[model samples]
Target: MARGPVGQITRGTTGTNRLRRVDRWIARHPALRRAADPLVVDLGYGASGVTALELHARLARARPDVEVLGLEIDPERVSRARAQLELVRAGGASFAPDARVSFARGGFEVPVPGGRRPAVIRAFNVLRQYDEAEVPDAWSTMAARLSPDGLLVEGTCDEIGRIATWVAVGTDAAPRTLTVSLRLAGLQHPSIAAERLPKALIHHNVPGERVHAFLGALDSEWERAASVSPFGPVHRWRTALSALVDAGWPVRERSRWRLGEVTVPWEAVAPG
Candidate 1:
């Protein structure tokens, strides 16, 4: 509770590709798609910098010359990641060439070295440690650090990257949409995403909130679509999503739903 030694140390749990879904999503985002200089921030990358490195490599496929910086509140963790990246760079693996993906020490302030506002900021599993009441302020602080055409993607995910939900925000600090991505092969119910919702919507999964109503409707649709389960969970999920749209949920597209993801306009399920 003290001040966290210059920057707050998070739970520090991380693994390879633990944030792949979000990374893939960011790669295709219109903000990063048209950026002249695609600078991205991996805020609170936990004990390891693997997720940051992975994000750089993944985005490079689309942006070709994307820059990623991993920021951690714990100096020790940052030092560890810096050493690993140095070793990789010495080996000539272009994944982190010229230190395009590097580590630093910072908190919600997002202290980028040269005071550069990044085009995209991805903070996965960072705010889940804070009280829900603190989410909006955190979102504001991070969003304000984005470039005029930037986006802030903040979310939570399971360690294995099985389920994830993130809110994409514009530079004005307004959340645009919430996206839920999961593996549909064995998905029981869409609401299972509640466990991994971003700090903003995690607590709002209770009664009387739009998110609560949204999940409730998803459960209902999933039940109605159970007949399709014999074909496969994926088929059942698609059916459930169709049912949701019929029920007027303002669902995104079948293309995304086929990939086990569903995005809704922010106002649709935003907290009241």
Candidate 2:
């Protein structure tokens, strides 16, 4: 007697630790820290539920009462995740036996039990296959299911998660910021994230768009910081980001630069 999921099934491509970058960012976000209910939704959690389990483990460090519900439109995927959860409960999986994580068949509708709105909904790699015009509707659908102060992180990452970029959307369905996270050890240029830009900005990374200009600035600063390469990639990244701030790029959370992340207000890179 359950209602059908509201979205289409995706390619379901996912991997272990593939979403680590965004998960780390979420761990420190104020939205999760101040949530009264602390319920998180891993919308369209792909072929496997491992990322959702990982999210629970990581976020639990910030709020022990946090609960994670992994939702998938594919019932077969849900069945697989439930099987994995059973392994965890039986002491045969990497996750804690008591980890507050569960899997269900759902999509943008975010059908949580008892009609509870979530504090955060992460829809990574979920909209990559959809048309650009479809994105706003999808964003609105998910954002509508959030708590008053909830966050909707929708974006993409590379195969091994070295490069990731995400858009932080609020309950109003308006994107607030765009964050690019990289593994600085061997990073060639910060512009590498340009390839992984979130769906909303990917097609807009042209000469006239704000995101393109921002990437251009990032690459220019990276080249200018070449002298800092002797210090280490982290120092070089820090220098490049400092240059952006100096150029009035509206960067946020400067402290996270050390972790190879740079977040800019969405207005700084939103499509023109």
On TM-score, the leading prediction is 2
Stretches of candidate 1 off by over 4 Å are 1-7, 92-99
Question: Across residues 1-272, which tens digit of lDDT does each residue of candidate 1 receive?
Answer: 54442335679899887888888889889889998769999999988888888898899889878899898888898999998898778875546565468888887778777878899999889889888878888888898889889999999999899899999988888999999999887778889999998888887888999999998998899889988788988888889999899989998846777778889999988888
84-122 in candidate 2: lDDT tens per residue?
Answer: 999999999888999999999998889999989999999
- What is the overall TM-score of model 1 with all chains considered together? 0.92
lDDT of each: 0.86, 0.93
Model 1 clashing-pair count: 0
Residue 46's lDDT in candidate 2: 92
**Residue 200 shift from truth in candidate 1, angstroms:** 1.2
Give per-model TM-scores. 0.92, 0.98
List the lowest-lDDT window of 10 residues for candidate 1. 1-10
Q: After superposition, how far is residue 24 of candidate 2 from its true place, in Å?
A: 1.0
Off by over 4 Å in 2: 1-3
